[model samples]
Target chain A: MDGLKKHIEEITPITNEEFDYIKTFFKEKKVKKHQYLLQDGDKVTSEYWIVKGIFRAFHIDKDGKEHILQFALENWWFSDYNAFFSQKESNINIVCMDDAEVLCLTLSGREQLASEFHKMEHFFRMKLTSGYSAQQRRIISLLSNNPKKRYEEFASLYPNIMQKIPKKYIAEYLGVSRETLSRLYSTTSRD
Target chain B: MDGLKKHIEEITPITNEEFDYIKTFFKEKKVKKHQYLLQDGDKVTSEYWIVKGIFRAFHIDKDGKEHILQFALENWWFSDYNAFFSQKESNINIVCMDDAEVLCLTLSGREQLASEFHKMEHFFRMKLTSGYSAQQRRIISLLSNNPKKRYEEFASLYPNIMQKIPKKYIAEYLGVSRETLSRLYSTTSRD
Candidate 1:
């Protein structure tokens, strides 16, 4: 609850009345490791904010290999964003990497909140802007950086993530082969 | 100016005063084929809306190969978005694919518009949402779809783009080799 309060405060100052209204829409859920919050083809009706533990959102490639798109830890949010916003069936699956607690908000609830609070709308808009900019940076990194540099940057950017996830998953996210990642790691270790 | 008016109207209604303020900030510029609107390491102060011909945003890989990140045609906008928003040096390059005419807006001008006109901010927010959704879809497509299917979908989605740009550039954007694209084109042509 403290984490949720802090997250909300970072976005906008929520009035107690507005906070109460928003609170009615959110339900807390606990998920065990390997349990799925969402699966491909599901209608993504809710977005989840992490209260505890680790979660990942990933897609299966044509060869049925999982490509991790995002890893969410405490105070972060995770969802099939494309499906949630577009009202389309999800192409991504979200699974808990460890025992987790999450706060969930349904799409309708979010829309209601936005309509009721202009400040909330502004907060969401800012969030989307930063998210969009980050995505743009990811694309540029994919284009400009070699696998080695990307791996180094990844480790530096999310030091905890490297310890929690497999190297293969990181390779997939970086658009490199596991073999390449292994070679890079060996070379870096030697250096 | 007419295209700009139409583009803005499609997003939101702007008053004469608001329109005048926006118009004052934009300067029309003509770029020769293969010329750059922005280059890597340069500060990206402005974004351009294409009025004629074609422009592309790309990055050079370690192997010195170009990867097309996006293309802009008539009525479309192009920028080193990461640089524009963050006020950092650009990692992406914006190059003219053909003799091009564009209307440009600086970062300060855009901020002014957002601060002065709530409608303008709403319009930009909507654009950002749609763009973010599209990027998510592209990521999914890259992960799930074969080169042939990707090309087919792109052709269907942007028929005008297919006719305007070279196949090689499209192949780069799809993260496929030109030879693979040629094979796909032959199969599609037969069908």
Candidate 2:
């Protein structure tokens, strides 16, 4: 769990003993491409921090259209946060987009870390602050940005994920039609 | 700043001396309706916590259209959080919709409180956690919900805000045309 240690250290320093104790709370899992991390109606007991690979958490609407909520790549943390925090059944699904490794931390473990270490609480707070900032940007983009601008913003924001994920999923995430995304992609590629 | 003290104590109790010290870090301001708390291109140095009245933070597009990013009611906190956190110029405007009073806290003040008191750190973290969870739910709603469903969801989720804010602003926030929102409002009222 060097990556986990490194991730935590990125925000705040920890002693060797603290790192070892913290490591005990996380469990590692390997997932194949197309495997589901979570599905609708499942209770979310843990939130995952990506160790490697790609995943998409999405909701399928009544019309059977898949709406992508977010894409998680290496080092990113994700869960159906609504369900995870409230300990309720999820209304969404998380599917591995590529072969992946993730470390899971249960709610109790997370609360324990925060309560046990001030530094850990600060680390988690910093992470949430950044996440909140990003989500605010997303909200404004959804409220105002055009398809071209949205695509450009998404590409610029997550360049690596842009390249790794399929064009169709990008199209869905941007709330644009596949044809529109295709045209934009070709134009972008040409440029 | 009794309200501020109460708000903080709602999460974690503080001693009278601690409350007095904390109050020094916050500056209170009274704003008239239509006055802008923040405008596009202005540097955002502080986050505001509302004590009275309503405000809407928005961006004006190149075509001269205003897109509401969020509405803040009493007890809500807001800013161009991206700019506020990074100490950069803002890309949005926050204008008062009603005569309002807000307490402004700079990044340094926030950090000082967090570092000095574990409970304060926990309080801020809990606020961010709730904000992050709410944003995640918003991302899904924006990606999947139709106009009618969006309006319904918004009303149910914030019935108080729904009553206080005008329908047109609610329409903008929901990303639905005013006409569409009007029809939905009338239908609901008639029912």
Candidate 3:
């Protein structure tokens, strides 16, 4: 809850009373490594804010190949947003990569908080603005079709996550082969 | 102004007085075909909401190959958002594909408007939510790397834009070769 207050204050400040009220909307959940936070076809009711540990969100195609959508680390937010916002069944799964704790906020709760406090609305908007920009950058990286450049961009953008995520998953996220990512990793390490 | 009001109302309604005040933050501009709205290295001071015609936003690689980032049609917002929000120099170029009109809003203007009215903040947040979701969908599409699926997804998602944009640009946007797109287009046309 302290972390949640800190996260919100990072964008906009709120009084202790406001914080206490806002904290009521969130419920803390603990998850073990390899456990699922969300699975395909489940109705997405809440978006989680990571309090500790890591998670991976991915989609499985008809051929059984998994396409990594995103990786969320501590203090980051994670959800099948399309489903969460629409209150529809999720097409992706979010699985814990490490033993973790997260604070879950339902859509109605989120809307209520935002509508209740202009600062909360501003905070959420700021977070979404950065998320939107990062996604745009990813789109450009993917469109360029330069594996080396993409790997570099990802590493630079999330240096901490770069060190923590498995190389195979990193390869999948970059849309490159494991062998290619291995080569890049070795070359990068040497450099 | 009507379109701008309508766009904002699509998410949240506003009083006429509020709309009048909100409209003051934007200035209208007209652009000619083949003209640039934004160019690489230029400081991005504003984001534009298209009122008429089409535009293409792209990045040029070291090899001078153009990688299409996105296409903007009427009602779509366009900007080197990475630069616009940060008030930094742009890394991409936005060129008008047809004679166009747009309403421009500065960063300060946007921030002030959001802070001045809770409904405006909610409106912007809702817009960003949809934009963020769209970008996430795009990342999954790009990572999948199936040109046929990508083409179909793009066509189905934006049938109007598909018909309006040239094949070459569409191929670039899908990260497929022009020839591959031609084959897909012919097959789809026949079907």
For each candidate in turn, the TM-score is: 0.87, 0.94, 0.93
Q: Which scores greater on lDDT, model 1 or model 3?
A: 3
Ranking by DockQ: 2, 3, 1
- For candidate 3 chain A, the 10 contiguous residues with the lowest summed lDDT are A155-164
Off by over 4 Å in 3: A177-191, B177-191
- Model 1: fraction of native contacts: 0.44
Worst 10 residues of 3 chain B by lDDT: B154-163
Better of 2 and 3 by DockQ: 2
Q: What is the lDDT of residue B98 in candidate 1?
A: 95
Which stretch of 10 consecutive residues in model 2 chain A shows the poorest summed lDDT? A154-163
Task: Kindly indicate the candidate among 1 and 2 with the higher lDDT.
Answer: 2
Candidate 3, residue B152: Cα displacement in angstroms equals 3.4
How far residue B160's Cα lies from its native spot in candidate 1, in Å, is 2.6
lDDT of 1 at A138: 63
lDDT of 3 by residue, A1-191 (tens): 99999988988989999999999999999999999999999999999999999999999876788988888988888799988888999989999999999999999999999999999999999999988888877787777778887888788767767668888889888888889988887888788
What is the per-residue lDDT of model 3 for residues B1-191, given as tens digits with 9 covering 90 to 100?
Answer: 89889988888989999998999999999999999999999999999999998999999876788988778889888799878888999989999999999999999999999999999999889988888877777777777667777787788657767668888789878887889988988898788
Chain A accuracy as TM-score for every candidate: 0.85, 0.93, 0.94
In candidate 2, the residue pairs with backbone N, CA or C atoms under 3 Å apart (3 or more residues apart, or in different chains) clash, namely none
TM-score of chain B of each: 0.89, 0.92, 0.94
lDDT of 1 by residue, B88-116 (tens): 89877888899989999898887677656
